[model samples]
Target: MTHVPSAAPFDPQTATIAIVTFNRSNLLTRLLTSIGEMDPKPGRIVIIDNASTDDTAEVVESFRDAVAPADIVYRRMETNTGGSGGFSEGMRVAYELGSEWIWLMDDDVEVLPDGLAKMGKWAPRFKSIQGRRYDYDGSAFYWQYRVAEPLGIPIPFAPAEFDASGYKAMNSGCFEGMFIHRDIVQQIGLPDPRFFIYWDDQMYGWLASRKTSSVIVDEFVLRRTREIKQWDMGIRHMNASSNAYRYYIMRNRAYIKKYYRELGVYRPVPFALGTTLTFGKELIRLVFVERTVRGTSNLFRGLRDGRKIARDASWQPMPPLEAATTTGR
Candidate 1:
């Protein structure tokens, strides 16, 4: 794919917002409404329906003529490609349609009025302060994924002091409210389709850090609509704990290790061992603690499958050719 230069100067009207939705029609409608209320509204809006069996298409169609300042375009995928695939398709469409920036959001995330504006302000600054070849420096970096504990439940991990300088190694961020420059997308290409469901954001952020600088804006906060409930092991526990999560965690981590290795960054053997132990702990938690039969089975299957992929010598890191050149300016 050819890298498209920034068509015109940076204007909110030229920024395209791409939202990927599954079966959450109601939540998607609210998110769309929030986008419509932005002060300097996005130029275009593209909604990719990931073969949702719900009323997602109808909800989008209802707002087609109603959303102001932003022209709405909807693409319905024939099959569910999970979050990674859906967003990849949405972003690709946005780039092809000549968007200067692509605002990627989850179906349930509600964007505050100032959300885009804040990103618009900080994105350029973040990209301008250079570090290494792939290192970006900026304020307001995003937090890794966090689940909301119920009223009585205690949060597990304490909020760690985010070392902005350590972003290259941390590779932590979420796509729920990520604002990405079109040029970066062109150069980085799309999110890994093999990821299919989970860890796509981490992988993309990892790639982004390598190409340019980025930081999470402190004042810019996007509210997550859905709360993380307690882990239930009964209904195919592995889907969440083992199958999807484990496979990507292992496969992608290996991919990252190999990538850095090629860059002449020597990874410690202990780090690899620690990562394996971490996965094993998660597996034990699902089987012994959570005691979910389905989760155990999924973990077993994921390990079996992931191990096979990890051993394959044909695995290769994705090139950064499709990355877009324009930062935010």
Candidate 2:
């Protein structure tokens, strides 16, 4: 059944969604199901598959008729570009398609039926609007909040600060339900695919916010169906147990530092100190808490790599997406 559009202030047809997936066709199917159930469906859907060795293509093919008027653009990458690169290409395609707004999320999340309509109502006022996220257990997935200047850690907003139409000033962004305008993309450029994963969205959102009005609209909700116990203490504690996660969390700081250096939005001294503290805190977690010897070693290796990355004299900002997909890396 085609769900009729509600009396929302903004038109639903102006927004598009970009979902990046890797080896999770089931979850992607679930997300598509959620989109199909929306009362006011999005104008378009863009799926960026990171070369998954599964039935992802078939899963997307099955949705062609279900979304009705909403165009589905599926791109199966030649290689695995990781989440950052995948989203980079995905948003690039969405930009070219000419949607006024772009909603980004991972395969693990499913939108509440009213989520887009709720956000669409508020979209007329803000340039970038992020929606609230709920966990699989239906608890508020509380990671959404502001970032402290220079340091860029996710600090919690006070209980009283949360309101349906109001929003706190944001210094970072989460891709779970991030809604950004096309103009912001034009000014800030697509997210750096080189990030490859962790902190990519945060940096992307920060750049957009720096250029335009960005806020978290409390009315809309995205259900984050995956559960994790690794992150806590406001974004400072990255209790990463996996070597890959630890490496990216540590190595990516170099890119972040370089970004700030180029942007010159925040002071350099505090940014430098804060970035070092990020590695130091991770070292303690790996060494003292988890007591993983190899994890700590990888942290150190990431730190070494990050320093080299920071010192790269020829580094460029927002390199072409094609270069990121192929040899420019």
Candidate 3:
């Protein structure tokens, strides 16, 4: 069971915007600008830099000077920690800094000027609230997933389902534009940084959903500035062609398996079959349709290596939040 502050009022001032950024200084600047334009502005902003060689530090310092009144703390990591590590550190810092609510987003996703105010309206209703997102072209970005009828592994949702209203239970989540309360952070701890990249956010979402009420407010919208490179697979949008992304996507099955087992929903044969079917389709597309053998080997290697990663009992979850980090600029 999770702790729910039943009658507590949600204070917008208690919100801290936790942003994880890499090399995209321009995108980060744009996001900070959006924050500057907020009607009810964010009280605090914690940026976790993933060790970018670019002028990420300069951008943060510039924003600190530009966005007066909003206290912005930027921490540049000693190494290039992936999204998982950056988010883990950012969430930890936000909670420790006494933020009742943590508004999480990647560097690429730009929050609408009104997005924070909109989500704040329903902050008192749910333990965890997920905001909606749009692609660059104003098209509906469907990061939400449809859990299998029996509620096991979540699959990509239908495009038509994007317009559905009324808050509903979500099986997964994207940090793309998620609003997380501190209670979930305290109870669930940080996202497993071991995931190192993809699917970690959804795993955290699954963990939070199991413990408390989590919902997506259809009215609140956050637009993603990242370009969509997905290949249309008739039934779903599969990865187009990225050697770098494929490695992490396939390698992180170990974390997903652990995620399911922790939730007591691990159906070995069924899960394996479901995964095989899903990946098999992509494998076929990679070899035949796209005719790209570049990342196919990674897919095979990831599947093979993930089995080992899942079986490692010694591996543990992310450590508890600690002291403040160095101001890296």
Candidate 4:
């Protein structure tokens, strides 16, 4: 059973903008500029740097005064922890700071002038929420998905437009623009860093949905600045992926399987079939749309590695928040 926290007033001052950035110092500067433009800026901004080889630290130092009034706490990791690990650390830092709300985003997007204010309007209603965004081409960025029960996978769902309620139910979470409450974080703990890159947000959001009605509000809060080749799928857009992403997409299925197993929804045959179907779909996209066989071998390699990981007896999930003292970040 999920415990619904008592309704309390939402304060913008209680929000902490948590960002995970890598080598994209240019993009990070843009995002910081946007945050500086907010009418009432966030109380604090915690940046988790994934040990970028670039001048990311110097760039952040340049923005100390740009986002003034809002305290900026930047921690550079000893090594590149990827997006998953960075987000986990960022959320942990924000949660320990006693932030009532943590707004998680990657450095690639720029929050709108009124982004935090718009998202705050629904904070009292939805504890776990997501905001809409636009692509570099000005098209709506797709971020809608529902969790498939029993199989415990995300199924992309798109609606023509949001109705009068101003939001839609969602289980698929994109760390790119997830606005979540501390109570939800207290329940789900942190995202599993083992994922490394892909599907981490989906699993985290699905876990959050188990505790409350996770939603993506109709408000447009972000605009993506990074441009990548994309295939229009009508209802959704398929962004071209890199070799690293291709490998992780397939290999991360093992972690997904572990999640289903923990929830007692794992069925060997169905899950295997689902994974096969996923592989086949990606394979087709790589051959036809991507028009190259550069990463073909990576797909199979990832699948083989995923099976090995699934069979490993030592692998375990991150413990829930209740098991921790909340003193460590």
Candidate 5:
């Protein structure tokens, strides 16, 4: 792990901001422009383009001559590897470039200038605080990291210790706008490429929690732009809700279950029961609720494939998806 320089330095070594972008050229440009305004500027900035066919490359190039303190490196992939692949590539590049800390931001998120500064302030404290554990009380648990209020959402602090019988960690949430120590990645490997999209961040964060505790920094605020659109289902080259998403969620959960089992951190009976219930819900939705023919077919296929992998103890490697050049029209 590289040593990160203090926020205040005489000859400052800057933190690196690594962003993963696809065909969202406009959003990417906005994020980059916002990053350029950060007060204590990052030392380096890296953008991994997931084979975007749009004007993404040109948009990035426009910022090359900007007077920002950070050195910009834009990389283009030959194929689109989805969010998981793009994030992995970007983080690897940032680490190899000797960044002390890596700030992972989604292309569609708009981060304010003070966001990193606030994160840096809270980071050391977050690492030092103890985690909250819970036991199953035979009641449903609604564990959430951020608490919503009439005024706004307040970040929840983890207690030093709590009951630990029949309980598991709640969702670790999304990785976007996350500030990570480089060593955490070194200790735990990169995001699982098997998870092409959904739950990749959750899996990575869960593994990291085993190495060192993580906290949701309340001060660092990021706004995510929600744009409704459909995606190509790979083979057909037709726009639809991605079948690949369903496949990943189903398959990778099994992979995660097995991985934890091997580590002696997971118990099979409860996990199996929980997983079955979860997948069964999806099955019910596919059969009774889902109106789209393609979506229903994909859901059934995902469930069948997922069960097959679990039964045979053999998981196939994911194939890269073709990159779409058009930012949803």
Candidate 6:
């Protein structure tokens, strides 16, 4: 695996915090407040506003000096590009700004006081690192994940995967607290904005692992501040997803297949089995956990759309960062 030379030391002054936010201005304020409390704040922040109709711009202005001397670049989108697009643009802006590390997160999570410091400890060794997180109730979030290579899908969080190393090698990534070195970004390019929501981070991280070992360090760095209904799944709790999100979860598999195909690892049988299992899990979530089947129709619709999307000869995967152009849209 390619290691970033020791000469390129990890420094907060060389890092940029990238946030993708939507209509939740209140949550954005809380997040910015937490960032202001960082002992050593990142050198820059790039806020990608996803065409929020709310007072998101006002909220950002209120914290203009939250981290003084660290410029905050707020770019508003003409349309809501969803989480995938926002993070894509966020990373692009930070990279163009010449940040050595780009830390990406959603606005709903609050950074722990020593989050940056903890992540910094591992930066000298790892090019792609993920920090630990807490759920709304202060329970540890299950994050350790591996990809099911034959199926080209990620296995569910496996807490046991973490051990004495204080970190575990991982092929999957979560955007909420994903700390990535710019070198990995240069190779994998940006997260595919065409994803619009689901599975983008996992694919991006997998690409990073191809260039270097990606890992999740066992250090609590952030806590989810938002509360939502969840069902305990023994190892972890599953949060209820929206109908649109459910559709994306299924439809986005096409992109996953496309990625695996490009890698020459795509398998039809295993992928089919994986898709069936995914559909079954969603059905259980909707019927047993959510106690509603109202969104069941979306599952079929998404599957159909995904197949059509897979056959589209025009669709292409994301290019490397050097070849990518940020539209700022």
TM-score of each: 0.74, 0.87, 0.87, 0.94, 0.71, 0.95
Q: Which ten residues in a row have the lowest lDDT in candidate 4?
A: 320-329
Best by lDDT: 6
lDDT of each: 0.61, 0.77, 0.74, 0.86, 0.58, 0.86
Q: 8 in model 3: Cα distance from truth in Å? A: 3.1
Candidate 2 on 1-329: residue-level lDDT in tens? 11123234577787889999999999999999999998889889999999999999999999988886788999999999988999888889888777777899999999889988888876766777788877666766665456766785554443424655466556578888888877678777888888887889888888877776677766546887666545455433334457776788888988888887787766777776776777776776676556666676677777788889988999988943222221110
lDDT of candidate model 6 versus the reference: 0.86
Location of the lowest summed lDDT over 10 successive residues in candidate 5:
128-137
Q: Give the TM-score of candidate 5.
A: 0.71
Clashing pairs in 6: none
Tens-digit lDDT track for model 4 on 216-324? 8889999998998877888887778888988988999999998888778789887887787778778777866698778878888888899999898987787766532
Q: Which should have the higher lDDT, number 1 or number 5?
A: 1
Where does model 2 exceed 4 Å of error?
Answer: 1-9, 156-165, 230-241, 266-268, 283-294, 319-329
Q: What value does the lDDT take at residue 63 in candidate 5?
A: 83
Candidate 3, residues 222-319, lDDT tens digits: the string is: 77676756665555455465665566667786677776776577777887776666566567667755667666777777788888988889876554
Candidate 4 segments whose C-alpha is farther than 4 A from its true place? 1-6, 322-329
Question: Regarding lDDT, does 2 or 3 come out ahead?
Answer: 2
Indicate whether candidate 3 or candidate 6 has the larger TM-score: 6
lDDT digits (tens) for residues 245-293 of candidate 6: 8898899889999988888888999998888888888888887678898
Q: After superposition, how far is residue 25 of candidate 1 from its true place, in Å?
A: 0.7
Deviation of model 6 at 323, angstroms: 8.6
Alpha-carbon RMSD of each model: 8.8, 6.5, 4.0, 2.4, 11.5, 2.8
Residue 68 of candidate 2: its Cα lDDT?
A: 65
Superposed model 6: Cα runs more than 4 Å off: 1-6, 323-329
Count: clashes, candidate 5: 0
**Clashing pairs for predicted structure model 4, backbone only:** none
